[model samples]
Target: MESPRGRRQKRRKTFFLPLGTSDGSYKPRQRAGHARSRQTGICQVLKRPESATNTVKTITGRLKNARTNPSPKIECWIPEKNPSNTGLVILPGGGYGGLAEHEGKGYAEYFCRAGIACFVVSYRLGTQGFRHPAMLEDALSAICAVRSAAHDFSVNPGRVGIMGSSAGGHLAAHTLVAWGQYESDVPLRPDFGILCYPVIVSQGPHAHRGSIINLAGNDASPELLEDLSHEKHVTSRTPPCFIWHTWEDSGVPVENSLIFASALKKHGIPFELHIYQKGGHGMGLNAPFNWGAECLRWMSGITGHKTA
Candidate 1:
């Protein structure tokens, strides 16, 4: 793909490399466009190799029923100039049922312009009869995929981070707190996190009920709910986070951000919290706020790059 100014910016569609298997005998499947950079506008769909199915089961204890949805994949966006060594995996929010385009591609475009390599994850969703660990598995796989392919994307493996909006924020948080439970040769924890008006607690007056129901179902047990409530699981190991929420976001209450920030504080984790008094849910990069700019500054501190 090319920008309107006639600058070359290539966007590629590719499947994540299969993660390590139980026996540790899996070899990465090779493809013609595995790391090709081109100006072609047509997106070539790369089939998920069979080895990845084993990887899914290894990560989440079960594979997503293939009949319910297509396998999860990521859309790559590399900057046209001075690409930063930083890479970010973006998870878009749709209450665990759908993906918000603005939050996915829109955020990707914004960060790619600032020289960050971006991957927009089309992870498994709950509305498709999928549930908790399915989404969590995909999130972990994305982090591993990016770090494993850091050389191909011109990114520093240690600088890779995860960003999500709304329910996607919950997914990011879940992956952050729950990473220690999953074993992987590749690091599953993000170096940092950017959560925009995330759905935090799974059971509370402030919880996003639709997200909880879709993720855990009405018959979910209290133990599962407590585990999914990310705030309750934060520890010193959790990565530094950048969180922002609007006081007017009724869809997912601002308290979600508040309590999570409070948890991060309790653990003495480095973080930045921004509370805007305007905008509702799913505003993406459209709101008349400088949260994006502030995030760039924070990211600069993390990456030691002048992203602004």
Candidate 2:
């Protein structure tokens, strides 16, 4: 069944946000919000890929099915210093179903201020039905779109990176692992990967089955679960990754990070791994002088970009 909010978010045909002004929230936050909105508006919607997909309509009559909604809109923020340079594409984590405002909007400026253009993706989620590759399709399309328009956006075609947290992290891993699957295809390869408390183990005792279940649905079979588990698909080609996870994560086992890092190292892929002693999960950009500072420094080291 469709909830009200999900229905509203899936309405994609229109350009501008549906009528009525945004209900005011924390004003300082709103000012930050406005800057981010203006930045996203500069982004032009990219073309959908030629991949074939199959799907059915939702109860709300919108295209909630995976294959039907292949294309994702692209929004960018070109840095003043490197106006026409390629940079990171930030895929905000929303458990494979939604994009959170703080991660997708408020957080984009951090990248824009840095010297890279930010591609905040508005991908279709599983509100309609569980589907494999729906998220991947959207992500791959974003990568290709950015790379194709690298000159127009001032993006460094060869230096583009992709980062995400949690479910978004899982998608990033999958995109990396499946990089070579499409032969004779445009280079959808991301130069590097950043996974924060990523859920890579999808099955087994240490697996994060909820993420897979939520993505594949209640009737998800074991075979489907195994297929999506990034650990199962790791190969030598998986991009160098920088990742971190809290030891106290209750949602996903810390093993998810360990196993992924292990796979990355085993495959000879360059990677940096960190396990914070404290801090619970979903601490989105929550740095209180202790954990956040270290995390920022780690990101700077890996991406070669300075941090605050």
Candidate 3:
């Protein structure tokens, strides 16, 4: 498949690789609030090679899911300066069925250029027989892994945060709200959060059904749906957040970010929300109305680090 438009930026060192061709085909389902169908976008057949290895240069680590088919991997992109004070773990949104490489590498390189170390996580999806907890676990694990290895990557463990787009935003939000609730090998909570057009409500008017289905399956119970609806879980303890959405985003409704931001506001959590008049779903880090700089500036304000 050809790379998405605007992905041809000057490259940085990376261990992240494109997920190979799909054997299964995807078809778009027409439904209300469906945003974009799975068939029309990048959701292709799954055919990941078993021989893929982690990179030593960029601190790529495979969080093997021995119980599943597509093993989760963490691709780190450390800034050239090394020992940066802050870092980010990125979760690319693909409706929880597939990973979007553009969101992964493209966003990582964008942040890396700003002097913030980043790790793009390709986690196990529900289509591979995994479910909600697996994606959440992989996200938390990626944060822990980054924090544990902060010294090696020249990052401050205390300054690490998580960022995600669309469905991946749901995972990042879950991580922020429920970090200490789960058992993990290292520190679980991120210092802050950056969610771009996230899937927040699992069962509301703004709910993203495909993302919900991919994470919890088509027959998810009411109880499961309630549990995964992250807006209801926000508390004063949740980390500060930076959220943005496009007003014209037909895929993941802009209301997803609005409702989540409202929840954050209700809980009195520090946050910054941006709703741009243009740009639609899955734009990655494309230029012309890209909000990456604004996000980075907000990050710098919180972390007390100058933008690279």
Candidate 4:
């Protein structure tokens, strides 16, 4: 992913996070603008998914460090309040190659004001794109990492959740199924999922090619397709979810969330689905949609948090 500054951006030399310090050393994001002083250099370079023994189940996918050296984990946003026994990890959308910063960091800031700690997961983007599983690995590892360090992070690990849009939304869905089905060391599930105009069912132009291609890998095997599709793998206990989409979207079809909602409905799992007449895909939570009131109200109802 090209940095926003690109070459013109003054490159800050690697100095904050030690190259090989084990995980759990970094502190959670604090309210106000204070950032962890230790990891001051490069942002957290994805590392191999850490092994977990009996962590709670939450969100799916896995993330690994791409670089041989570990960089300091960067806190893109500051929390205005403390963790409210519940926290959220955000995976912003970017078609598996790059992350939409506006979607990721800007969205996480909402959790802060609402008194929920948020970890904006910057998973490894595909350089020309990595395998489908690579993004998944990073996503899952991030959730587990937060869960694994719940106490240190100032909240209850049991109530962690994940949210995202577009490609990220799809990963949030895929991760739950992966945890229940895979043998990965990281915990494979999320307690709750909030998908904003997710790209769940991929069969149209709005269908995320990067998502499909990444999940399928180069050969494009049938088994891989089956594995990455979250709708097909949904179980009775796939966790509570809150989903929303707009009919106006030309990118990822609304049917993606519709199918996911149908599956959730069939499974009798607790969920809330809000199909808006406006607000196209990837509107960034607080966009100029008239239904902002409805969306926020719905989110508060589902998560039981107040986001003002």
> Model 2, which residues run further than 4 Å from truth?
1-69, 183-185, 289-308
lDDT of 2 at 222: 78
Summing lDDT over every window of 10 consecutive residues in candidate 3, give the lowest-scoring window.
37-46
Tens-digit lDDT string for candidate 1 (1-308): 43453322222444333222222122334334453332211133343333221011111112222223223578777664523478788999999989999999899889888878888888887788888777887887667666655555566777888999999999999877877776546566788999999999998799999999999888999999998899999999999999999999989999999999999999999999999999999999998887888999999888775662
The local distance difference test score of each candidate is 0.75, 0.61, 0.72, 0.61
Poorly placed runs, candidate 3 (over 4 Å): 1-71, 82-84
Candidate 4 C-alpha lDDT tens digits along 1-308: 54433322222222122122123233544323323543212232232222311112222222343222211132322233453356677888877767897777777666666666777876666555456666666666666556554543454555667888888898888776565544323344677888878877644454577667765555776776666667887888797888888888777888888888888888888788878776666787665664445644655654565653
Q: What TM-score goes with each of the models?
A: 0.80, 0.72, 0.77, 0.71
| Pick by lDDT: 1 or 2, better one | 1
- Name the Cα RMSD for model 1: 8.1
* Per-residue lDDT over 10-101 for candidate 2, one digit per residue giving the tens place of the 0 to 100 score: 32222211111111111111111112222111233332222211111111111223254456765565554553243676777778767766
C-alpha lDDT of candidate 3 relative to the true structure: 0.72
Which should have the higher TM-score, number 1 or number 4?
Answer: 1
The reply for model 1, stretches above 4 Å from the true place, is 1-71
Error of 2 at 201 (Å): 1.2
Q: Kindly provide the TM-score of model 1 when superposed on the true structure, using C-alpha atoms.
A: 0.80
**Cα-based lDDT at residue 254, candidate 4:** 87
User: Who wins the lDDT comparison?
Assistant: 1
